[model samples]
Each structure stands twice: as C-alpha cells, then as structure tokens.
Target: MIYQDTFGFAQQQDEQDELKSFRDEFLFPQHNGHKVIYLCGNSLGLQPKSAGQYIKIQLDNWENFAVEGWFMGDDPWLSYHKALLPTLSGLLGANDREITVMNSLTVNLHLLMVSFYKPTNKRFKILMEAGAFPSDQYAVESQVRFHGFNPKEAIIEVTPRAGEVTLRTADIIAQIEDNADEIALVLFSGINYYTGQLFDMESIVKAGHKAGAMVGLDLAHAAGNVPLQLHNWGADFASWCSYKYMNSGPGGISGAFVHERHFANDKLNRFAGWWGYRRDKQFLMQPGFDPELGAQGWNVSTSPVVLMAMHKASLDIFEKAGGIVPLRKKGDLLTGYLEYLINNINQKQGEEVYRIITPKDQKDRGSQLSVVCKRDARAIFDYLAQNGIIGDWREPDVIRLSPVPLYNSFTDIYHAAEGLFKALGATNA
Candidate 1:
C-alpha cells in the first residue's frame, strides 16, 4: 500500500484490514455527537459489546441457581475460570497448567514474589528497572522489608545512561553478570510503561538463571500489546492486568504464570489458602494444605465469575481476530505511520518541539509512543482533550498515544497529528 497524507489512506487501510469489523464490537465513547478518537488503550481499553451479555448470563445463573450455582449450572461457577484457560494460555504462549486468571495486578505480583523471591544472606538483592511502576516499587519494598532487609541495600535498580530515555539490553545483562553473587531475583516489566520499551525477556531470563537467580515479569503493559513466549523463554513467573489492551474493563481480574518446572517442586514456598488445596480433598477440610498441581494452586480464594465473564468476552474477540500475530502486524504499520507524521511535524516547525521518547526501532517498543513536549506541555494536552483527541498524560510532560489495531484506524493517527499541530500553534500564539 502506498502511504499518503490523507484520510483516504486510512480509509484504504481500514478497508484492507481483516480485523476492521472487530471495532464494532466495542463501545466507543461519544463527544458532541461524534465518536471520540480514543488513543488511550494503553491505559484502559474500551468495553466489549458482548460484555453485558456475558455478565447477564452469570447474573441469571446466580439469581436462579443461588447457592447451587457453584456446581449445578451448565457453566458452573466453580469451573467458570476453566473456560478462559485456553485463550489466556495462547495469549501468553504458555501451557494451560502454567497459567491462571486470578486476583488484581498488584496482588498477583506479591503472591508470585512470595514463591519466587527467596532471599538469603549471600544472595539477597533484587534487581529491577529504575523507574518501575509506583505500585511495583511499593510491593518490592514491602516484600524486602517483610524479610527484615532494608530496601536501600537489598534493591538494586538498573538505569539508562545519561540523556537516554530507554535502557539497553547489553547494560542490563552486564549488570546481572556483575552482581551474580549478590542478586537473588530479577523482576522487570515486560514493557516499560512510560517509555514503551519492550525488554529482552529471553536473554534476561537466561542471564538471571545462569547467575542462579529467579526471574519474574510484571506484564501489565505488555500483555496484549505484544506477543510473548513466557513458557518457551523459561521465565520463573509472571503477572499481568487485563484492563488495558485486553479490554476487560476497569479493575478486571489479572493473571499469573508459574513455570511447569515448579509444579512438582514442593520446596517452593508460597502463601496458600483453601482454594489452593487439592480439589478432590478441598471439601474434606483437611488439617494441612496440599496445593493443587500447577498455577491454579496459587489461587487464594474463589474465582470472581463476574469479572471472568467480562474477560472471557474480550478473549473471544482475540480468538476471532486470529490471535496476536496478525494484530501486531497491523500495529506495527499503524504506529509506524504515527511516528512518521510526528517527525514530519518536527521538521516543519523548524525545531524539535516534540520528541518521541520511545525507541525508533519497532523491535524495541510496543504500540505506544511517549511524546515529550518541549514547552507548554499541559496546555497542548488540554487542547487535545478539548478537540476530542483522547490520549493520556503522564506527570511532568509525556503524553502517551497507542494506536490499538483492534479498534484504532490510521486516520486516528493522522487526526491526532493534525490536532497536535494546531494545539502547538495556539500555545505559541
């Protein structure tokens, strides 16, 4: 397809998109009797039209079956989560036994840490990216404190070189090798939330294991945005929230992955509850806990069926769209087009007024582009909001825009650039 600076080009792209019909499945917000250009899927995804129906099915089962819904209905409440396993596993590139949907994002992070971050005097330090999400920082700090270690001394953070917005894989691997004796764990976001940088997961996992350290990932931003091979990469554990690219709605249930290697290893310590007990003997109310064989054993309570219903609705869409590969292909083209237009604007303005902090190479980033405004950042952001362009602004000066392939169009990218140019002109005036 010949790229052109016209809405017709986006219309042509949409016409050629095999997954374009999927956009109708979402509930797009409206402003001034028009559909708002939503570029914030990196933050919260649009709700699926099927979500209401999915929830209603569960509500009906709950109202009619009442207490008996746990075991009696066609899709019993107890096994409702089982229906989602195949789809979730496919998305993570993991075995069914290694993946499960449960808890919120931060809660799952702590639970996975409990089993994986076993620190001792000789190798007690945890290495992580320098600017991890605040919640992750808090969780790791509390986990360190729980073991009676000072976070300042026990947490080792890897940062980018001066004037660089993203971390280099070589630097990360080198740090692991240098601290091989002191580091007990390596936990990083599969994709950095602010910079949209996709970390080298396979190499990092290999390096950590070679150094005798366990590795885990907080995939909150990476989950549906990029293709992952958690099982093949031999990652020790991982966790992710579903509300962003997965379109599971706000505060939807999250998921976790525990490598099958740990399934039979009884020595792997974890915080367990009744739900984690063996299913056949759970009702026996045994004196001791014999955990379930795999990732399901990580569950602490009954699965939330209502939230799972919404998640299942989104996964159904993913299945119909032919999984992540095709979507990622379209994502690359869409985001690349956005980058092209933005750089063109910088040239026209005669100075670099806005800079994309995300890496230029598609291999190093996901769908998001973090634009750093040189001046009048807030005013430019406010103008975009008033003009019906919906992207998110991080603290200080970054505005994140993600062109999700499932719903966003190339025209969305074009209009965003046009709106930004107008906003910049207004600020100067």
Candidate 2:
C-alpha cells in the first residue's frame, strides 16, 4: 500500500474508486466559478444534488393533499419517518425498533440524561472525556446543576497525561475503576470532535456496566463517519446529528438509540410529550401519557416532513452506495494518503511546520486529521481558504480537514496537501 505524491497516483486511485461517482451526487461550493475541494464533512457535509427534488416532492404533497397529506399521500407523513429507520438501524448497528428520529443531539442528550443519568446518595458523579464538544459540556454541566449538585464535584473529566494530545484507553479504564463507587453515569463521545480520535466504545461500556453505572455516547461526529455497534456494544443510549457526515441539510434532523433492554423499564423517567404517546391510542385523546414501545417513546413533538425529506435524500444515497462499510474503506485510503503527503512536507522542510495531533493509527481515527501549525497558524488557514481549499480551522492553532468518502475524491486530498505545501512558502515570505 505504498502511496505516491504525484497527482497521477491520486487520479489512478480515483479511477479505481467504486464510490467515485458519489462525488457527483453532491453540490460543491464554488470559488471563481470553479468548485472548491470540500474536505469539511466533519463540520457540515456538502448538500446532495437530489435534495431539492426531494423537498419538491414533499412540497407538492403539501400542495395537493393539504391536511390530507397525513393520511392520503403516496408516502404518508404519518409513516414517512419509518422509511428512515432501516438505513439508520444499519448505520448505528441497532435494530429498527431501537432507533428513532427525534430532536437535535443536545436536546436528545438532555432527554436521555433524564432517564440514564439518575443520581443517588451513594453514586452521583458522571465521568466523561475531557474537552468534549461544548454543547455536551454545557449539557452535562446544566444537568448536574439542575440535579442540585455542584458540577465541579459531580462531573469527572478524564484528561490525557502530560504532553499527550490524545487519550490512552488504559487511562480511561483506570479512571472509571477508580471512581467506580461514586460514578452514576459514564458518558463519552464516540469520536472526539477536535482530535478525531475514535474511542473504544465496547471496552468503555463493559467497564461502566461492571462498575454499576449507565454508559451513554454522543455520536455526533461518529455516526456516519465510522462504523458503530451501539446495540452490540451494550450502550444504554446514544444520540447524533445528521447534518455533518449524513449530509442532511444544515441543522437537520437528529436521531437517538435506546437499547431494547430499556424498553420495559417503567421506572425510567422522561419529559413526556404527546408525540411519544402510543401510536395505537394517540388519536384517542387519552388523559394519561403512555409512551411507545422503544426509542420512539423519546420523541417530543410533531415530525417535520421537510427535514425528513432532506435526510432521506442523503440516506438514499448511502443505501445506493451500500452503506458505511464501503464508504469507510475509501475514507481510510483518502485520509492515509493525506497524512503521508503532510509528513513528506515536514521532512522536506526539515522542521515541524504542520504537526498532526490526531492519532496515527487508522484504527484510532476516521477521515479527519487535526494538524497544529507550528508557525503562522491562522495565516496558513486563511491562505488555504483564499485559494478555495475548505478545511476547518479551530481556535488558536489547529486546522481540521476531513476527506469524506462519499463526496471527497483522492484528488481533493492531493490538492489540499498541495495547498499546504504552497501555504508554507507563502507564509515564509
């Protein structure tokens, strides 16, 4: 698996890519009348070409059927969400009954915490990785405060050892065991948004369960970017946003997964809403709140048909490409090639110009590589953007680039590295 720096090598790989045609499925951002090489799928994915058509179908349904669209349409709004479950079930590695489309990721996180983050006099602390997404940090802090506990006391952050950018699995497990008696919940992101490090969910879940705590995962970055096994991993609950890797529109619909084991746990608490009421008795207008059997029990309000249409447009493409397995294969090669090219740049410069902080092992990361600029960090980022290369920039020093397998080509990776090479010289001047 030797990689060459020549653009021809990238072109040859593109020629052999089974998923190359997927690049045509998306609409890219233009710079000077030419499409920019989009490598920011880790933040927001490119829109699918068919997204407009999908929305049009729903709009036409609204026009023709009006109120009757709920019951009379070809694809009834009543059951439109059901079509999404099969693909999502496969993506999240859960049964269709265990997954449901619902509120945004943070909203669902709070809802799930209501049920899973129960604190007691004996065990009341929550353990999580340090530097999770700010929304998750805020959510956990607020939830802890709402429960009448000081966040500083109730929340435990597992930070890396000195001088280490990424966490080691051993440290994570030891921290869980050390606080075993006091930890009520162990929640972590499936992949850290900054470093792009994929946590070992299976080991984490087993450790938490053995220590008498509920384990949950926020899969916002991990959902479509990496293969997950929420059910098999035995996670109590999980939530993810679809806009990033799923290419559903900006702020698109989010999804949740509740293990089947929790289905009949009547002792669990929820912020009840009518949409979560049993479908069979929903229209009966009952006074009591009886929730649906599985994850649907978490739904809070009416389904937005338009958002579902956008989500379906992208998911249908995933189905056509045979799901995340094939896409992830190409993603590895694209990212690997990018890493190789970046290393070569550092070698030629005789100094660390772009220092990659993400884990080097393919198994430890996904499509993203977070590089810290040793010099001219912000200038380097602006240079790439001005040149029409779309890698994301984090505060202070890091630039995050994600070569999405579905829409990003090997040429995109090559051109991105080429931009980095040119940027080094420009900044030096």
Candidate 3:
C-alpha cells in the first residue's frame, strides 16, 4: 500500500478505520489539556475507561459479602481468574485448560524454568537470542548458577551477524542445531524488546524439538500484539505480562501457557501452593500436593481479584473488538504510515538522519518502530514530549514509537511524525 505524506491522508485513513471508535474506550494521558499521542503501548498500555468500574464491582462484593466473598459472591474471588480464560485462550491460541493467570513476568519465567530447564551435565546449557530483556538475562544467569554452572559457559547467545539489525530465521535454527549437543533449553522472546523483531516461534520450536531441547517464550512484548498458536507451535511453555498490549494496569498479573502434553507428565517439577491444589479438595487442607489438572498447577499464590478485574475490563474490550484480527489490520497500516513518513524525511534531508532498526517486513515486526536518530537523539525525544507525542527512548539513541491498535489513531501517528519533523528544525536552531 502506497502512503501519502500529508495530514489529510492520515485523517482520511483514520476516518475509514472500522475500529476508530475503539479509541474512545481507553483513558489517555493529558498534555496541555489535550490527549497526548500515546505511542508507548509497547511499554505500558493505556488504561481502559471501565477499569475503575470493574474494580468497584469487586470492592462492592467485598463490602457486601465480607469473608464469604471468596465463595459466595456472584463472581467468587477464589475462582476469579477462571472468568478470564476464554478470552485469553483466544488471544493466546491455547485451549482453556492450557493457560492460567498468576505472578509477574519474570517471576513466572523463573517458575517455568524450574520445570522446563532441568539439565544434565552434558546438555546443561541454555540457548537464547543475544540482548534479551535484562530481567530474562538475570533469570537465566542465576538459574544456571543455582544449578552449579557458570553463566558464561551455560548460556549460548545467538546474535545478529555484525551489520544486521535482526536475526535471520536460518541463523537462529542453525545456532539451535549447532549447539544441539550441549543445549538443554532454548528460550526466546516472542518479540525482542529492543529491536521489535518478532521471532518465528513456530520454526524455532520445531527446530529445538528436533534437536532434543525444550523451547519457551517470554511473550512480554508479543502476547496480545501478535497472534500466537502456542499449542499448535508445540512450544513447551510460555509467559507474558498483561500490562503492555493486554492493557491490564501497570505491573498487572502475568499469564503462562503449558502444552497439554505436559499436564500428565509426572517427570516435571513444580514449586506449588494451595491455590494450585485440585479445587474440590483444596479446602480439605490436605498434605501431599495434589495439583490441579492443567496450567493452574503452576499457581503459587491466591488470586489478586482487583488486578484480575482490571484485566477483565480490558479483555472485554478486546472481545468486543472481535479479538486481534481486526485490530492487527489497522495496526499494520498505522505503523506503515509512520515508517513511510520517517523514510521520506531522510530522503528530503539527503541523509539517513533517522534509521529504523526494526525489521522492515510487516511479518517480522508488530506496531513498534525503533528509530535511531542519527543526530540530536535526546533533544528530539524531548521535543516530542513537549509536543504531546510520547514515544519511549532507549539508552544512547533510538526512539521507540509503537502505534497501538486499541487507542492510537492514524492521526496520532501523523502528528507524531509532524512533531518529529519540527523537532529537527528546533534542534538545529
């Protein structure tokens, strides 16, 4: 699709957007009494307008039912997360029994590793993409050390070829094959947080399985942003934070998926809590850990009702929007417009003042475009802030702008590009 470099063109696109009214569902941050162009949904999603109301219902249940709220209320706190599974199942492409909501992103990652990353002396190493999010890096390093192996020896990082900004699928598969002997686990992010490169999870899973290793994904950036068939892909396990694309509140409850194949496997280890006990006998206060049938067996604590309420509020909107298929359609065009405008700026300037390090192919990325400003990177970011364009910044350079399909409009992307264009002149002076 050819894009025109004009505000009118952007407005026209927004006008034709079928999901345009969905923007009104979220509460945007204000700037100078106006809604800012919020392009940081990749970091923290905008809050849904109904979030407070949803929380109030839970608050009311607590007030009316007191200690009985856990079992007596219309939506019992004991099984609150059960209400979320259908929508989440659709978003994640998993069966209702395969997914469960619990813990934060990194915490779930550690919990899952306890089960999936058991390594013998020969195949003790973990293979991952280079430059994984710092939390994952720390988690893997500590997990390796806890098992009495040096991180430098136990972690194999698959990096891009010297000049490339993204990993080629062949390189990733070849690396998995190259380390087949010593690698016990293959862990990767569904989308690299830094480069916004969406990895080929299906190919990666098939390769890792053939090489005799378990594969898992940290879907912090991928979960709701991209369509995932975790079960069909045969990934052993995966986890994601809801605060980003799922639009649960900041530090919202995270979720995990375990393939149905793992459900009956007694060989897997877990650090269990009462919440994971079989629901019927959980209240009997039994001794031996009789785990729940599926992913819920991984739950280590009681449900956080208010957070689940907040999450349900957002998922309701996704369900109303007909899930991700329609949202992704508008998202691609919105992101494409921003990329086209940035490239046009470079062409007119007669130099590559802004280099997009994210993959150029639509299939290889989501809404994020990580643009490295060749000049005045910091000042330019500040200028966008002042003008109510809120894209996040990485250290040294690279302004990360993500046009969220839920709340962000095509006009938002256009104005953000306009602010960036003006920032060039503002910084020059």
Candidate 4:
C-alpha cells in the first residue's frame, strides 16, 4: 500500500478501513475539549466503552445475591474466569486448558520460574535477552539468589553486536548452543519493550529444548499486539499482563500458559493454594494440595471477579473484531504509515532528526516505533504532549509511538507526525 504524507491520504485510508468502526468502542481522553491523539497503547491501552457495564453487571449480582453471588450470579464468581479462556486460547494459539487468567505478570513469572527454572550446581544458569524489562530482570536475579547462586554468575544475557539495535536469530540460537551445557532455562519477552523488536519465539523454543532447557516467555507487549503459538511452538510456560495491548485497565489481571505436556509431570513444583486445588473437591476444603487438571492449577488465590470482568469486556471486543488476525493486519499498515511519515520528516529536514530503532520490517515488529530524537528529545516529547498527541517517552532519548489497531485511526497518526514536525521548529534544537 502506497502511503502519502498528507492529511487527505490519512482520511482516505480511514474511510477505507474495514476495522474503522472499532475506534468508537473506546473512550479517549480529552485535551482542550477534543479527543487527544492516543499513540501510547504500547504503554497503556485506552478504556473500553463497554468496560463499565461489564463491571456493573457483576456489581449488581453482588448486591442482589450477597455472598451467594459466588454460585448464584449469571456468571458464577467461582467459574467466572473460565469464560475468558476461549478468546485467550485463540489469541495465544493454545488449548483452552493450557491457559488460565490469574495474578499480575511478574508474580506469575516468579511462580512459573519455581516450576521451570530448576537450576543445579553445574547447570544453574538462565539465558535471556539483554535489556529485558526491569521487572523480569529483578525476578530472575532474585530467583538466582534464592537458589544460592550469585546473579552475576547465574545470569547470561545475549547482547547485540556493537552498533546493532536488534538481535539476529542466528546469534540467539548460537548462544543457546554455546551455553547448552550449563543453561537451565531460556527466558525471553515476545517483543523487547525498549526497541520494539519481536523475537522469533518458535526458533528460540526449539533451540532451548534442544539445548536441554525449559523455555518461557513474557508476552506483555506481544499477547494482544502480535500472533503467538505457545503450544505449537512447544513453549513450556508463558505469562502476560492485560493492561497494555490487551487493554484490561491499569494493574489488570494477568494470564498464564502451561503446555499440557507438563500437566502430568509430577516432578515440577508449584506454590499451591486452595484456589488451584482439585475443583471437584475444593468446596470440601480437603488437605494436601491436589491441583486442578490443567493450567488452572497455577492459580494461587480466588479469582478477582471485578478485574476479570474488565478483562472480559475487552476480550469480547477482540472476539467481535475477529481476533488478532484482523487486528494485526491493520496494525502492520498503521505502523508502516507512521514510519513512512516520520521518514518523510527526516528526508525533508535533510538530516536524521528522528532515528527509528524499531525494526523496519513488519515481520519483526508490531505497532510500536521507538524513535531516538537527534536533539532536545524531552522537549520534543513535551511538545507532542502539549499538542494533544500522546506518545510515551523512555529514559535517556527514545520516544515510543504506538498506533493500536483496535481504537486508533489513520488521522491520529497523521496529526502525530504533524506534531513531530512542528516540535522541531518550536523547540529550536
């Protein structure tokens, strides 16, 4: 698709968009009495207009049924999360039994590590991408320490070659082979948070397993942003937060995936709780932790009905929008248009004013473009914010602009580019 750097072209594309109607399902924040151009879905998704009604339904059930709402409501609180599994299973490309909506991301990561990250005196190291999200870095470090290994010695980060912004799949596979003798686990994010580079998870899983290690993924950016096949890829476990691309609201409930191949493996350990106890005998309050049949076994506490309701509201939209396949189709075009416009700005300026660090190929990225401003980065970011073009800024110099497919429009991307161009003159940098 040819892209033009004019507002008219953007309006024209918006007119032709098959998913254009989805933009109305969300409630955007206002700036000076108009809707702000929201390009920060990489950080936080806009609220779904139907979220309130979903929550209110559960609220009404609570009010009317009192404590009995656990079993009496339209969606019984006890089995409420089950309703979410079908859509989630489709999104993650796994069996419904392999998925469970549970705690937040990092917490689930730590819990999964307990079962997958079993290190020994000789094979006690974890191989992961360098510059992983801070929460993941901290969790791996603490887990290493808890197992009596110094983090400095137990952690192996695969860094890019000098002057490179992304990892080559060959380098990643070679690293796994090089460290095979000692590596106990291969942990990675589906998409790097900082550079917006989508990792080749299928290749990573194969390499890790061949190297005699378990594989896990942190899909916070990738779950709703890209396609996944955890079961088919043979990933041992994975987890993701719902607040960002999944758009379940701030601190929303998270989901975990455990391949069915591991379900009968008794050697694996879990930090068990009654919520995960055998469902048939849960009401009996029996002793000895007998876990539920599948991924639900990972649940450590009762489901948070309110948060799940918010999650359901958003998942329902994904279903209506025909799942991630269609969303991804539009996302590629929207992101490509933004990259094209930003490139035009640099070409017109006769210098690289904004260097996009995200991969140029659509196959290697989702909706985000991480741009490094040549000068006055903070000032330029503030200018965009002041102009009601809301993107997010990373530390140091990068600005992340994500044109989410569910709610963002082509016009939004056009005006955001306009703001980036105007910021240069306004900041005088």
Best-performing candidate as measured by lDDT: 4
- Model 3 Cα lDDT, one tens digit per residue, 357-395: 999999999989999999999999999999899999998
**Could you give me the TM-score of model 2 versus the true structure?**
0.99
- Relative to the true structure, how large is the alpha-carbon lDDT of every model? 0.92, 0.94, 0.94, 0.95
Name the runs in model 3 displaced over 4 angstroms: none
Kindly list the per-residue Cα lDDT of model 2 for residues 112-192, writing each as its tens digit. 999999999889999999999999999999999999999999999999999998999999999999999999999999999
> Which residue pairs collide, candidate 3?
none
TM-score each candidate: 0.99, 0.99, 0.99, 0.99
Q: How many pairs collide in each candidate, listed in order? A: 0, 0, 0, 0
| Better structure of 2 and 4 per lDDT | 4
Candidate ranking under lDDT, highest first, comes to 4, 2, 3, 1
Q: Once superposed on the true structure, which residue ranges of model 1 sit more than 4 Å away at CA?
A: none
168, model 4: CA deviation in Å? 0.9
- In candidate 4, clashing pairs total 0
